[model samples]
Target: MGSNAPLNVSAMVVNSLESSGIDHVFLVPGKLIYPLLDAIDNSPLIRGIVGAHETGSAFMADGYARASRKFGVCAGISGPGTMNFVPGMAAAHADRIPMLYIAGGISSHAEGKGAFQDATPGGIFESGVVRSLVTDIVELKNKENTQAEMRRAIEGLNWMRRAQSFISIPVDVQKQDVLPGQEVARQPYAHGEFNACEVPANRAALDALCDQYLFQSKRVAFLVGSRGNDAETAKLLLEVAEGFHIPVATTLSGKGAFPEQHALALGVYGFSSHSRAARVINSDELDVLVVFGSDLNQRDSMNWSRRLTGGKELFIFDDSFDSPAMGHISRQGIFSGISASFRLLAQKAADNPPGLPQALQRRKGWIAEINETPLYDHRFEQLGDRVSSGDEALYPGDVVKHLCRILPKDSNVVVDSGAHRIFMAHYWLSSGKGNYFSSSSLAPMGWAIAAGIGVKLAAPERPCVVVTGDGCMMMHGMEIQTAARYRVKVIYVVLNNAAHGAIHIDAIRSGSISEQFTKLPCHSWSAFASSIGVAARVVERIDELDGVLSEACQYDGPFLIEVITGVFPAPNRYYAEAEACP
Candidate 1:
């Protein structure tokens, strides 16, 4: 038996998070989790952000993690509230973003009973349906070992695995007092305390893999992902790229991993890829393809295009590389940081410096020339006249162009999943100083709306922008109010093409499907933002974009720029791939 001094498990959990350096916790207030919420309220080191919906809350956590480079935290109750975390958590899992979802389950003794929201073995609602989506699920039924279990779970958030973690605490145990308050206040979790994490490959194997696949290759290319964004890793990556005379390209989620303006830079490859990047990666001269911190599962992988990896020797550095069929030099992920330890070993002899391939030189010049003007896809021949006229009355590119042109030097842009994201991804040029993040695979709509709030809260110094579309706004547009309530400064540029942009475009272009289901009422997002206390302006033309964005950039509080544009598809090859799927 333990000391019966007053110590609440909920209170200890909040303290543990604070000690772990988690400053914020997003949640939708629920009865079962009230104790934990109250604990957060009393804590001086942590804050509780009440969200409009659990899904939005989860996404805010995802955004927070991406912005701060720290694991995100969210809370919910079992059953319905827990259910809302699926799409958001799945998105994080797909993007390999680190996050933790804490849910309050029914009483420990209430197992198979008719407890309202029990998720236990024989409960009415078994939340384990999301087991595969999350990295780990822990149900805390034993009250005594709560602190130890909490530490283990928090430490589990290391370099790899996939998605967010689910921690279910029983209601009875949450309120129970089993130890002294002083003992409970102990720091159970710390940001870097658990540094001894498992590396994907042993040092010897990694070196050998690099020797045969990297150093021996005549032409090598680097494809970095989200994990390649850290300062040390990015610096090391640039050094390695220069050291090896390699051209560096990034996955969709890795836009800012390397300075895009560099001579050796190849922009994003995959769905919203640059012709230059697709060409570089798919070239016959390429002998090696090295990927970092990404599974390359999203459009970032061009729907796992065989041509992308067909004849090349592929090397990857991500803790979450689970794709068995694509093949690799090492089945396990190689840490991007390992470049530090292996750089000298893989260095080309100084006397025999490799010259840039003649073909690559031309392709690089070609890409730079293409980027000199506004990126216009020749594939969309139907809209050639409107595209040439520079009328965005149906094009979101104008808005992205204007925003990219005027955005502050240091800004954080969080893009939601939609046609608008494709525009932003395809056109936005990054300097490696600013931050860019998007949920790739399980791209739940409205993720950026809430995620923008989290980004603003996490990186308060930078100008935060959320680029979303009408379909996403309809999903969780009200989350802007959450930003407004906290006085969190963020710019939301909602591209209202009046429909689910991509679906509508694909359906209309395919001619095999009904476009009626893809169309939306084209609701006025500006009016909605004003109704909810977020200042907003509607942009219906290209001329109105520059100044509207300039003023929004200077605005201190949350602002929305609703650009009424068209669903002009990005020059993406996805439509063809999707058509071929059947």
Candidate 2:
């Protein structure tokens, strides 16, 4: 009974997180997890951030993971608290984010005894997480067994890259003792310590495919996705496009994958897409299409339009050969990393030059045609010009465009789901990798505020700006207090449109006259932010936008700028086209 124990099970768990390079832990405090909280508070290598809600905690972890390119950790209590994590975990799962979810369970003896908050752990998150483990109290009591289980959980996380892993510790087990010098073991995979893996490309096979399809084709295009949207991949893509006279288009999630300002870049494709990109992707003249990293989902592919890929010879480069996102159009699918595949292809092109003067001239013609033609509707163009003067209420697109010009090139922009997201997606220019973050697959509202806080915590030096709608902000506005508490310098740009803008737009598109239900009562978001000790401002005119944004950017702490924008239509011609078709 008097034996010397080096640490407790809770301490061992914390040690494992530290070894995995996780520096921040987002959690909601609970009595069941007091021991774990105490351990985290005592650890020098990790810091604990309390969230306003369990859902926010999970989203915060997701933000940290996406921004830092490291695994994020979030913990909560049993039952309701665990259930709150379902939506956020599902968002991470759908978007392929790595998150470590920890939860407290009822005492081992309370099993089948109708104990308080006695729901089964990990049951709610089974669909969202890759693996879930419920630790046995008896196993935790033994030092060797504890180490083995910890290693097993971490190994599962490492193997299942970009997926969530769940582990639940019973209240009784968390207090168990660990023997001296019983540290968790590290198992490094060939793909380094994290999810960034490089698969060797088959140079010969790639060259043959490129010569047959790319070099000989009359029209070729590249569709890039979030997976291969990094700077290294982007640079290689530009070279391939320029060398072979191809145009590049990206998914909404991959908006910043290629520089939008480049002449060869066609901007985003699918759902609320740029007119030029959609026209090129749907053109019958495009004989060859090379897709990289994107899943080619309905949102990104416009319900998998036959016009977009039916006649073209599709070449897909993804991490897995059996990706469900590839659809049925790919004639050739390569199971290789996007960067590695492109690198080999780029090298082969250099070795065997294909001098296609006609193709180059055609590509130049296409660019000039797009530049001369109006991309957006005439009504939207007029609104954009009027909003620039700040004489009337601000438009979401104008706000995003101004922010793009004002913020530093390296600023990390996190956008929440709403009609505003479409505006931001179309207008925000991303110059670097990981500079823009949004959850398009799941499209969860209120994600940006919490996720922005996590992004700031991960990259303290970089400016993290959150663009959210009024309705979206109200859902998780309390998280602003969490940011203030941690001194997270995130500028909250609240587009205060007094309605569920997306729902209103949907109703209008459906020819419904009764959209009053979507309207919301206006609130003073600036006053709310100031009450929470954050620097706040209300921007009523376009003239005030620049000065307010500049001041918020310069502020050393949390800041909120509420811009009163009336409900307006997004530049979404795809919705209209889909409605009219069939």
Candidate 3:
């Protein structure tokens, strides 16, 4: 009965993941995915991370990918369990984080017969749940071609980390043994989704960029994005900027893409950006703007304001510009393979050094003004003494400022959505470590609570911290228990405002009738976190906050620090500019 039958569809799928450098698979156990889950549990090379919920698992996979620069993998059963992955999938899609999603599906025999949890094309809801959100979907109905289907799906993800790839295998097909002579996908190969095919720069776009913009433009600036945040690109980018004397600015999603302290840096140009950065990007006098890896969506582009792209020569470079949302934006959309283009430019910088652009030199006074401006000049640190009715509550901005000052310069910080994200992105001075990450496009509520666990798992040597809010903790906060289960050393600092900080502040300021719904229940997060076996502390004073954070950084296990923050004095005006897009 066991004659030459060592591998089945499930085994092959698990092997493919291992060969592709996916050492962990985050998932929630369910009926249909039992075969795959069983294989994952048995695999010696891959660890299965069972989580509290499917979406939390998906977010963990996303964080792992962001931290490791490898493909993230997660799974769920069909229908309900699979549907829970929507928000996380959409977040990964918008941020262009590459991931492989494997989920169970309808049995091959009962696919169109309305089988329970059927995910067939004719089943209930059809594929409407994730049909549009993911990059591509692979449905394996025939066991004979399972490997081929997986290969096709992975190749699509390889093109660019643009979206999550889905693979759904019918329960019947998942249990079937591999056919003869067909590779069972057990044989190891090079990494699958990272196979970088050289996408040569669009010759026409490159010519225009060189001739009209770089050589002849009056003023040029480099606006880098998340895609250009890697190590090699940073150095190459610096080479080109130093060679051509182009001022560099980054989108909010692209923070830490360039050294903020560099003389040529204009800080961030999108949400919570410096005034000089906005002026430099939108100025009519600036001749050309070179954008690498940003989609310039509503948030980054000021809701498609004419001033951003209308008056400047915009050269947009990336792996591809296929987003339909970008259709209205006028510019030369170049498929330049960002790293390749940067390498070429860096080489040119060494061979032929063009003198500094005279136009850039003419703007020296303006550049000097922004450079002279201190990044941490906001005066909110003294607010606790003056405000808060003597409750010993701290401002969220001060919390972020103190964390940035004391947290190890080498640590990786994950910013979750809420008032905390605004303060961190706007006030945290990046030393160009390229370790700061935020899911800006989607901005899901409790992402970092789960994602930071995955981040810790991915980079065990690096100290990881999650900056989140009480409102976010109310959402997927139990994910901290998942961190505790694994003993992931992520220090979660929750700003306990007893309300949705941003909305509450807005209600109080706007005098709006919606204030009734803005307040949240006051609860001791440290107590709850401790009950779940996580080391917990409630910071009651500013003087003690630094010591708490420092201790947590040195701790060997998961920790949570709840800082009771007063929502008032609200991060000053400059750091709240991101609300414009919201």
Candidate 4:
């Protein structure tokens, strides 16, 4: 009854995590997990943070890894519980965060024998997790190998560090026993090694390509990706852009990587990207397009493939790169380690002086032209006017921009998935490296609320904000209570559009506004916020936005503000419609 039973598999798993420096595990209890839960209850080295749902647990772990640069663990029951985490796991995998997923599994002998909740736990998580393995490490027959299996799990967890990995332990094995190890030493996995992209080979060949573009082209551009929280890389890319007098555009993920307000900063160039950035990409101003760490996914790529015509295009990326099955847009592809590529570019710039002054001047002119370009109609701005006056009623975009202005130079911003991401990318500015985070690949809802809590927990001193749409707010609204219980001081700003604004707008554009069942009736978001034991306010007008945000920032604990916003077609959708007409 004391669970002093010889080394339970669950105890070994917890010991392994403890050795690997994982101090916290997020979990939701279920009957299948009783054995493992029993082990967790007994472990002194690890603590379990009970989450409201499986997805919340997974998101919490994902955020912990993203912020702390270490592995976070999540545990759940098999079948339905594990299935609930698929979206969060997908986001973790796509975004490359280190997280371990532990799920309680049915006995191997009883599996598929019509046992209750007899799903193939590993198979269900195969696509979502980097790897899925089931172990019977506590088998009495293999008492000596219990520690070995634990070590293997830690190694496997390391592989999932940037991707979600699953360790499934059969209930019977977890309840059974094996001889405990003589001593519990910390298990070591891969040490500090750069998992970033490897630099491309054929440097001489690339130098020839760069020389040709430098001598022949009138305009060139550096399309930077998220530099993995490396501001030095950002500065180096900016220097290269300045050396060639070419504009630098960024992906949404690339927003904070380059200070967008800079004169040479072209703007975000994706589906919801700025008009000026789109114009530059659309125009003949591009002679050589250099891309870095770009996923080139639908949202980031503006739903259109880059057509390589008279000009040449180059891509430098890490693991997030997605090569289209149709074809590639690049004349030459470079997978250089990010730092190595930067070094090479620096040397290349130093060696070749291709009218640097003239190029720099030409780039300045291009920047000026971009600054003068008009933007999309401000429908949200008009909506803010319909509510209240002053800062309390600022549009979600304005609210985020203002936060950027006041946020400490070192604070990080993590956004959940929704239409609100468009606003954050377009307006928010980061002062230094590692300033922003979001899930663009899977774009799952309910991520930001839990993720913000995890981020705050990981870096309590650093203020974090979760800017999410009402739809997203609805998905994870309850998690605010979790934040309150944990004393997380993250600010939550909900862009309330009265409906599923993004989806509604998409439906309206396609001539089917009536089918927007995704939209919700106007709800008392502030009242709901108050129920979570956090301060809450609702801004119906534009002018009230600033004061509320200021107070929220100063609040001692978690806070929420629901700002009414109007939905409009995103930039890429506008273009797609125009193309459809012709």
TM-score of each: 0.86, 0.89, 0.89, 0.80
Candidate 3 lDDT for residue 15: 74
Candidate 2 colliding pairs, count: 1
Better by lDDT, candidate 3 or 2? 3
lDDT of 1 by residue, 312-393 (tens): 7777655544552334223455553443433432343222434424433544554455455322345542344331123547
Q: Write the per-residue lDDT of candidate 3 for residues 452-571, one digit (tens) a residue.
A: 988888888888999998999999999999988888899999988887877776677676748678888889999999999899998977888988988898788999999988776444
lDDT values of the candidates?
Answer: 0.73, 0.76, 0.77, 0.66
Residue 64 shift from truth in candidate 4, angstroms: 2.5
Rate residue 505 of model 2 by lDDT.
63
- State in Å the error of residue 85, model 2: 0.8
lDDT of 4 by residue, 146-209 (tens): 5665555455344222434566666777776666443345433566445432334346645764
Local error of candidate 2 at 338, Å?
Answer: 1.5
Q: Looking at candidate 3, what is the lDDT of residue 127?
A: 58
Q: What is the lDDT of residue 270 in candidate 2?
A: 83
As for candidate 3, its clashing pairs are: none
Per candidate, the number of residue pairs that clash is 4, 1, 0, 27
Candidate 3 Cα deviation (angstroms), residue 140 = 1.7
Give the per-residue Cα lDDT of candidate 3 at 577. 45
Flag regions of model 4 displaced more than 4 Å.
Answer: 1-8, 38-47, 107-114, 120-161, 175-218, 226-246, 305-310, 316-332, 343-396, 506-510, 515-518, 568-582
User: Model 3 Cα displacement at 31 (Å)?
Assistant: 2.4
